[model samples]
Target: MSTFKAPKGTFDLIPPYSATYLAVRDAISGPLRRSGYGYVETPGFEDVNLFARGVGESTDIVTKEMYTLTTKGGSELALRPEGTASVLRAALEASLHKQGNLPVKLWYSGSYYRYERPQKGRYRHFSQVGAEAIGAEDPALDAELIILADQAYRSLGLRNFRILLNSLGDKECRPVYREVLQGFLRGLDLDEETRRRIEINPLRVLDDKRAEVQKQLVGAPSLADHLCDACKAYHSEVRALLTAAGVAFEDDEKLVRGLDYYTRTTFEFVHDGLGSQSAVGGGGRYDGLSEMIGGPALPSVGWALGVDRTVLALEAEGIELDIPPATSVFAVPLGEEARRVLFGLVTELRKAGVATDFGYGAKSLKSHMKNAHRSGARYALVAGERDLAEGLVQLKDMETGEQEPIALDRVVEELRAKSA
Candidate 1:
């Protein structure tokens, strides 16, 4: 019989590489943590209609990509395909909006599921670090989210990413642009599905990547041209704030992101290094998303950075993260008596805040030393029966191939001083 394997389109994160993924997540969430964004977590799966209504029935995420299931109790649920909608739902359910704070800033990191055809940077199961600022309508809030994301990428030493900014006018003006865009899209030589999308969400047609479809969109109307006075000023203020903060961005009038909830400010972080899956992260203001999901009119903005794609981008640029070793010291005890003594020392060292590992399974000295070397430890504490009898342990510096005898009572103090 064949051994089991991970399901198709999904992959596991293991070992040394998982460390890099963790570092990327920490880097992305660092700015949010410092800027009053509290950590928030939601269920891996949520009520199906939460997404269906919040993310919009017309978008691909809700219609094609979501992983859904029916419970034995006859309730429908879906593994969260993205972070924003679920986060908003959680915030509203808990009445975070009712609190004195107008905007409930939050940060989250976790895996999201989507039934997409997996590729290098895209996966059926993927990880993201996301931030949300709920219950605010100020343009500065929009700019703040964008600036924080920029700071995160820079903190990771990434320089090849570009920010694409756009404005999807809110209720008052977007309808006018939608009508004009629809009229233009209707006349295009497109397939049946493309035609259907034009009527449902014409802006999404602008996001279509096919060369044939793009060719006919050459003279398509620009949303920037139809922005109402209020929307134009709001978008302009967002641009000014980003510029004042020295965050560079390009105005991409056609960037209507994949989500149907976004309105007013929309921005995407794209890296040229990642080929077709260039978008490492993106988000925008979803001013009406709260109402769409049956909550109060709470304007919000947020972004989710793809951890898997960010790691890929790091490789593309040939950058390595400086991750310290997990184990700083390895303890190898020889003989049963030495094992008991050294185990006590190991516990004491660990309590002293030293990262220590031990040689388990009573391995030979040679095997234990080899394991110590593989652990990336800076020092190894090797104690045999003879050394213990002398009230001593052999301290071996893994780096310089040097060894010295230290009094057993002073082991912890000596190691701490050496490490310092």
Candidate 2:
């Protein structure tokens, strides 16, 4: 049979590139761990109603891209297109809110499925590093989340990213603004789908990427102007805190997020290097989402940063990720007797917390050394018959090409000391 290919819109993270994925995960999660955001995981698919309600019925995720299926028992489920809805569902089910902690801080790294036409940086399946803070409405919390995300991107030595901030107007005034927005959009000559959006969520039409949609949106009533006194005050507080924290942001008057549940504060991280698809990551506050999903009124805010997009951003900026070297040592055996001894010693070295590998299936010395270089081993141990008889091994520094003999019994200790 011909070799099977991966499903359309999805690709495998094979070998050398897999290391880069791991590095990005570690680098991003480090700050969250230190900041006291505990790790949480949820099922890839949950009840279909979860996203329909939590993510919103009018959004593209539930309306267009969700992969839904029915179990044998007849319950409907869907592969999660985003993490926040699932996380919030779990938190509500577990009653994490009632645990007396004001804001339940969570950090997650996992795959999300979206059934759409895949393009560069956008995929049917992708991994994300996301953070959520539930049960809090403090502007400081909003600023904290933005600052930490900024810190993570900078820590990776990534430049050419801009943080855009906006407020979607709180409940006290957003409904009033939505009416004005809807009225204005209804007058524009647009597609039936967009006009339908004006009836459902007038704000979402602003997020449309189509040039045709953009051209007609010029005179639409902006949410920023429609904000009531209370909504305006809350937005000012968030911006002030962000500014005080030294995080610069562009005030985007038309930055309506894709999701419908967001209220109060919203923001996005965009990279200039990645053409057309400039958004590397973004998050916003969803004050009413908990109530929307049949839970109590719990306010929350979070962001999901795209790992694949971030890597693309790095490549666009002509930046190289400083990945760690693979194996530290490669063991080369001259003969059967030497192989037997070297295998045991290899195990001992590993037990001492060293990354060591052996040349398998009795390859020639030249081929074994070439394999060592290919594996990115820094040092190679040559255990020949003579060295085995003498209870010693020759250590050759791969890069330096310098060799030295050490007693076999002290192999682990010697390697550890030298690597240290």
Candidate 3:
């Protein structure tokens, strides 16, 4: 066994299982691509201040989970705990917001790092496929993002996941709500850490999971009750669009996501099967984020779906993706001369866009055929000295165990036809 191992809470995806990850990423990105959301990538690490300022310092992700580092040059950097901040920073640096485009639509897939006690669906290192629509404040954009995510999940046969929606009242009314919440929280029996949160970010206290703390929050104030007319109208239009689009969501009064940037139209996708870590994905409108990061006021909305959590959700539902065979056609050559001829055929087949593999070294026909079976190939090509002499090759259907001889020169064309 190798001495080295992946760090705790991290995993290496290999083989057939890894295919699911690719499928999930593609499934999510496909809709965004068709909808005009171009792909954008950013470095895995960035100035530590970027997240502290953008994701909010009081949030648990900034205070406790962030993986930080200090360089020899005395620069403090951090592996991004989330994608939105880095994505926005890249867009700002590139001046995408300055372009004529009102909303610079984008999609990205990558790994994010955080430090936490990993559990079944929660990990220290995980993957997410995210989409963002920047520089727009329209409720339609918010509805579109939620619709796109819903379509992606439905296309993947995810039936049990539900959308939790809320509007975290925009700047107009949030201050008033915060003060009211502070008053309520200040009167509670709380710990020093909880009390400190009350001052820095009272909304975060509503998200506390501790049963004892939750007991005290039974009569706490809710933001939905204090949303001003403008915020209320904006949220109502978002809900109306989603309803018209056939997307169902439940109003969740307590859904103050871990991030502090969200304002109005906040949401989460949760699967009941995922236990306490129920959220598979979530995001909201961040109208103030660009300004917070020293960029122009570019309102944005986005969501990052957890690839690992999605996989777990699929397993819980007992649904298997219809993945094609890794190798479509595998060739087994009986002799050295046959090896040269079949190797050429393998190359030709692959160049023709067929997924093909071949046997290596000296091996018995039976053994090579066995390897072909294990490869999950649809067809296996077998050519021995006698067959080569006749310029013919045996094509065996792995699924049906049926074999036939075809002209050697016509193998590639025949396989392509059959595979297609």
Clashing pairs in 1: none
Q: After superposition, how far is residue 180 of candidate 1 from its true place, in Å?
A: 0.7
Overall lDDT per candidate, in order of appearance: 0.94, 0.90, 0.94
RMSD of each: 1.1, 1.2, 0.8
Model 1 lDDT, residue 382, Cα: 95
TM-score of each: 0.98, 0.98, 0.99
Write one digit per residue (lDDT tens) for candidate 1, span 1-420.
659999989898898889999999999999999999999999999999999998888899988999999999999999999999989988999999998788999999999999999899999999999999999899999999999999999998999999999999989999999999998988989999889888888999999999999899998999999999999999999999999999999999889999889999999999999999999999999999999989989999999999999999999999999999999899999999999999999999999989999999968999999999999999999999999999999999999999999999999998888767
Q: On a 0 to 100 scale, what is the lDDT of residue 122 in model 2?
A: 88
Each candidate's number of clashing pairs is 0, 0, 0
RMSD of 2: 1.2
- Where does candidate 3 stray beyond 4 Å? none
| Model 1 spans > 4 angstroms off | none
The parts of candidate 2 lying over 4 Å away from their true place are none
Which candidate wins on lDDT? 3
